[model samples]
Target: MTILNGLKILDFCSLLPGPLATMMFADLGAEVIHIESNRRVDLMRIMPPYDEEKESYIHQHLNRSKKSLQLNLKSEEGIEIVKKLVKDYDIIIEGFRPGVMKRLGIDYDTLREINPRLIYCAITGYGQTGPYATRPGHDNNYLSVGGVLNHSRLKDKKPVAMGIQIADIAGGTMHAAIGILAAALHREKSGEGKFIDVSMTDAMFAMNALYGTQYLGSGRPPQPEEEILNGGTFYDYYRTKDGRYFSVGSLEPQFRKLLCEALEIPELIDSTFNDSSYTQQRFKEAVTDAFCTKTFDQWLEIFNEDFHGCVEPVLTFDEACNHPQIQARNMLVDVKKSDGSTQRQIGTALKISGVEPTYQYVGAKMGAHTEEILKTYGYNQKEIEKLKANGVLI
Candidate 1:
C-alpha cells in the first residue's frame, strides 16, 4: 500500500501552492477531493503550455490523481455538504487569503467542530495573524520582503528576479505539505487535530537563516554574491564559448589544485585562494576566462571522467529532464494523459528503497466528480438536483 493509503484531503484551493501541496499527498495515495465553483474554473486551467490532446496542461500536472467537486460555498446546502465531507476526511487544505475561508464558513474552527481530528492547513502570503497578514501579495513580493532576493542578485548589480517561484512552491507549498503531514502525525498521538497557519513570507524569512546568523553573530552584513558558498569566486557559474555555462566549486586546496591542473594554469597553484580581498576577484576572472576557452559539453566530458573535479555543466530544462544522471536516478517519468498521450512528469524527489511510487490516477477534468462526491457526503439525487437547480452546486 502507498504511504497515505487511507488519508482523505479536502482541497479547497486554487493556483500553485495549495494544489501542489495536496497533489503531493495524492501522489502518495491520499484521496484528494478538489472543490471548485462552476462560476469560475481555477486560474491554472488556462495556463500554458496547453495540452491540445487533453485541452488543458493545468489539469495534466496539478490535478493528477485527484477528484473534483463543484460547490457554491456561499449556499447553505453547499456548506452543509462540505461539512458532511469533513466528517470523513482527515485533512483540509485551503489557499484563500486570510479571511476568505472564514467568510465561506469552512474555516478551521467550523470544520474542527464537525471532525475534531481533522488536520486543517491554511496557506497564505503573510499568515493568519501579522501586520501584513491581510495585505494582498504573491510569491515575488513575499520572497522579496524576506531577503530571498538578496542571495539571488547579480554579482555587482541590482537584485534580479529568481528563476522559479521559490516562495510559492518551496516556501509555501512544500511547507504546507509538511505541516499537513506533521499535523496528521500529531493527531495520531494527541487524538485531536490542530490548526496549521503557514505563511509564505515566514517561510521565505527562514530561507535566510544562514545569512541572518552571519549578520547577528559577527555583525557582517549579508553580501549579495560574496558568501563563500553562494557561488562566489571559488564556487560560481562560468560561461563557455558555445553560450552554455558550467558551475564549478573548487573550494578546498586539493580541488583548486585539480582545477588549475585541468586548466593548465600552473601559476595558480599555491595561490592564496581563500583571501576574498584581491585574490578572489582575480580568481573569478581567471576561472571565467578558462571556461570561455571550451564548450560546455567538452567540460562535462572532462569532469565526469575525472574524480575530485567539483564541477557540473549547467543543463537547460529540457536537457535536465533527459540528463544521464537524472535518468539513472529516475527523476523523470512518463505519465499517461487522459487522451492516451504520455507526458514527461517530474518524479518525486524522495527515494524510498523498498517501496516504489505508483501512478494512482491521471488528472481529472474540472468538477468531474460532483455527483459522486456529493453522494459520498450523503446527498441524494433529488437533494443534489434541488441544490443544482438553486445554483448551489455549480
Candidate 2:
C-alpha cells in the first residue's frame, strides 16, 4: 500500500551509502534482500555500544525493514544463488570500489545479461573510472577532493572535521536513491534498465551549488568566512556568558530589526542595510558583545517574546529530540522487535497523504531471514541445510 510496494531490491550494499539508500526504499515499502557474508560481514555489525540485546545500535537504525541473506561470494554456489535471486529482483546496489563485483561475476554488466531490466547502481568514493577511482578514501577524503572543505572554514584555520559523514550520506546515499528512482522512471516507459555510477566526490562538487556557481561565474573562488552564510554578515553563531551558543540568521530586514530590537540595540539596525565588510565586522562585534552580557537561556527568553526573528539557540541533539516543534511534527516513534521490545527511533520525514512508512523491525540478527528468503527463491529445507553445511549461508 506504499509508494514503492512493487519495487524489489537485491542489495549487496554494506555500510553507509548503499545500505542507507536501500533502507530508504525498504522504509517506503520495497522488498530488500540484504546480501551479507559470514566470512566478511559488515564492520558496522562489530562496532561498539551494542544495545541490551547485543545488537549494534547503529545497525538497528540503518538496516531496519530489510531481509538479510548470508552468502559467501567467494564460493561458486553463492554466485549461482545470487544470480537466481537477481532473476526475480530487478534492482541491485553494490558498494565495492570498481572491478570487485566484475571479478566476483555479478557486476552490472553481468547481471544485466541475466535480467536486462535490472537497474544496477554502484556507490563508490570516486566512481567506476578516473585516476582516483580505485583510490581508497573515506568521507573526509572525498570532501577534500571535491573542494568543499576549501571554503567552509574560518580564516587562517584548518577546516574542522565534520561531526557527520556528509559526503557518504548526503552525497552518496541521496544521489544513489535519486539515480535509481530516475532510472526506474526511465524503465517504466522504455522498459530498459540503467547503470548508475554514484561518485561521492562528484556529488560533493555539485553541492558547492551557489558558491561554486559564483566562483565560476565571476572567476573568483569563494574565501572562507567571506560569504554571507559562512560568516561574512552577522549571520553566524555567538557564544553567550554561559558558553552556550545562539545562531543568528536574521538576514532579512524585518528579522534583522527584530533581532537588534530584542538585543536592546536598535541603533545597530540602520547600519545592517550596508553590506560593506567593515560595517559587517562592526555589527558582528557589537552582537558578540551584547550576547556576552546574557546567558543563552536569557537571550532565548527574549527572542521568544514574539520577536519572530530567525534566531535560535545551538541546541544539543538531546534538546532537539525534545523540542516542542520537533515533537509536534511526530518525528519520534517506537518501533518493535519480534520479541515485543521496542526501540525509540526517529521516523521517516516523508509524509505521503495516503501511505504510511513501514518499520518492520530493527536490524535483524545476521541472516535472521535466511531460511525464509531461501524458501521463496525455490530452495527446500534440505538444500538450505546443505548450503549451510557447505558454509554457503551462515
Candidate 3:
C-alpha cells in the first residue's frame, strides 16, 4: 500500500507553497480535493509556458494526482457545503492572509468545531501573530528579511536574485509538508488535530541555521564573500573559455591539495589554509586564470578523469532535466491527460524503500469533479443542479 493511502485533504491554496505541500501528499497516495473558486480562477491556470496542446504547464505539473472542485466560497451555501465536507477530510491547507479565512467563517477554530481531528495548516508570507503577519510579500522579500539575500551578494555587487523561488518551495512548501506530517503522527497517538502556522520568512530563518549559529556564537554576522562557503574561498564558480561556468568545491585540505596538483599549481596548495585575504585573492585569481584557458567541456573531461576535487560543470535547465543521474533517480515522470496525451513533469523526490509513489494523471479541468464531490457529500442531482444555478458551484 502507499504511504498515505487513506488520508484525505482539502486544499484551498493557490500559486506555489500550499498547493505544492498537498501535491506531495497526493503523490504519496492521499485523496487531495483542491477547493478552487469559480469566481476567481487560480492564477497558475493562465500563467505562461503552455504545453504542446496549449494547456497550462504550471497547472498540469502542480496539480497532478489530485481532484478539483470549483465553488464560490463567498456564498453561504458554498460555505455550508465546505463545512459538511470538512467532517470527512483529515487535512485542510489554506494560503490566504491572516484574517481572511476567519472572515470567511472557515478558519481552524470554526472547522475544528465540526471535526476536531482536522489538521489545519496556514501558509503565509509572515506568521500569524507577528507585526508583519498581514503584510504583502513574496519569495524575494522573505529571503531579504531572513538574511539569505544579504549573504548572497558578490563582494560589492547587488544581492543576486535566485532563479528558483527558494522561499516558496524550501521555506513554505517543505516546512508545511513537514509540519502537517508531524501533526498527523501526533494525532495518531492523541486522537486530536493540530494547527500549523507556516511562515515563509520564519522557514527561511530556520533554514539559515548554519549562519545563524555562527553569528550567535561568535557575535559577528557573516558578510558577503566573507565566509568560506559563500564565495569567500576557492570553493566558488569560475568562468571557462567558452563563457560557461564550472563549480569547484575542494573544501577539505586533501581535496584542495589534489585540486592544486591537478592544476599544476603546487605553490598554491599551502595558500588554501591561509586565512590572509591577500593569499585568498591571489589563489582565486590564479584558479580563475587557469579555468579561463580551458573550455567547459575540456574541464569536464579533465575532472571526469580521476580529479579528486568536487568539481563539475554548471548545467543549464535543459541539461539538468535530461541528465543521466537525475533520470536514473526517477526524478522525471510522464502523466497522461484525459485527452490521451502525455506530459513530462518533475516527479516526487521522496523514495521510500518498499512503497512506490504513483502519478496517475495530469491535472483535471476546473470544476472537473465538482458534481461528483457534491454527490459524495450527500447532495442529490437536483440539489447539485440548484446549487449550480445559484452560482454556488460552476
lDDT of 1 by residue, 206-317 (tens): 8778887888899987777777767555688888989998888877788888888887787876665467557787777888899889888787777774557687778788
Query: What is candidate 1's local distance difference test score?
Result: 0.81
Q: Can you tell me which runs of candidate 1 are displaced by over 4 Å?
A: 271-273, 305-307
Ranking by lDDT: 2, 3, 1
Clashes of each: 1, 0, 0
What TM-score, computed on C-alpha atoms, does each candidate reach? 0.94, 0.97, 0.97
Which portions of model 2 miss their true places by more than 4 Å? none
Q: Residue-wise lDDT of candidate 3 within 94-134, one digit each (tens)?
A: 99999999999999999999999999999999999979999
lDDT of 2: 0.89
Clashing pairs in 1: 38-394
Model 3 lDDT on a 0 to 1 scale: 0.89
RMSD of each: 1.9, 1.2, 1.3
lDDT (Cα atoms) of all candidates against the true structure: 0.81, 0.89, 0.89
Model 2 C-alpha lDDT per residue in residues 108-174, reported as the tens digit of each score: 8888999999999999999989899899999999999999997898889999899889999999999
How high a TM-score does candidate 2 get?
0.97
Of 1 and 3, the candidate ahead on lDDT is 3
Candidate rank order under TM-score: 2, 3, 1
Q: If both were scored by TM-score, which would come out higher, candidate 1 or candidate 2?
A: 2
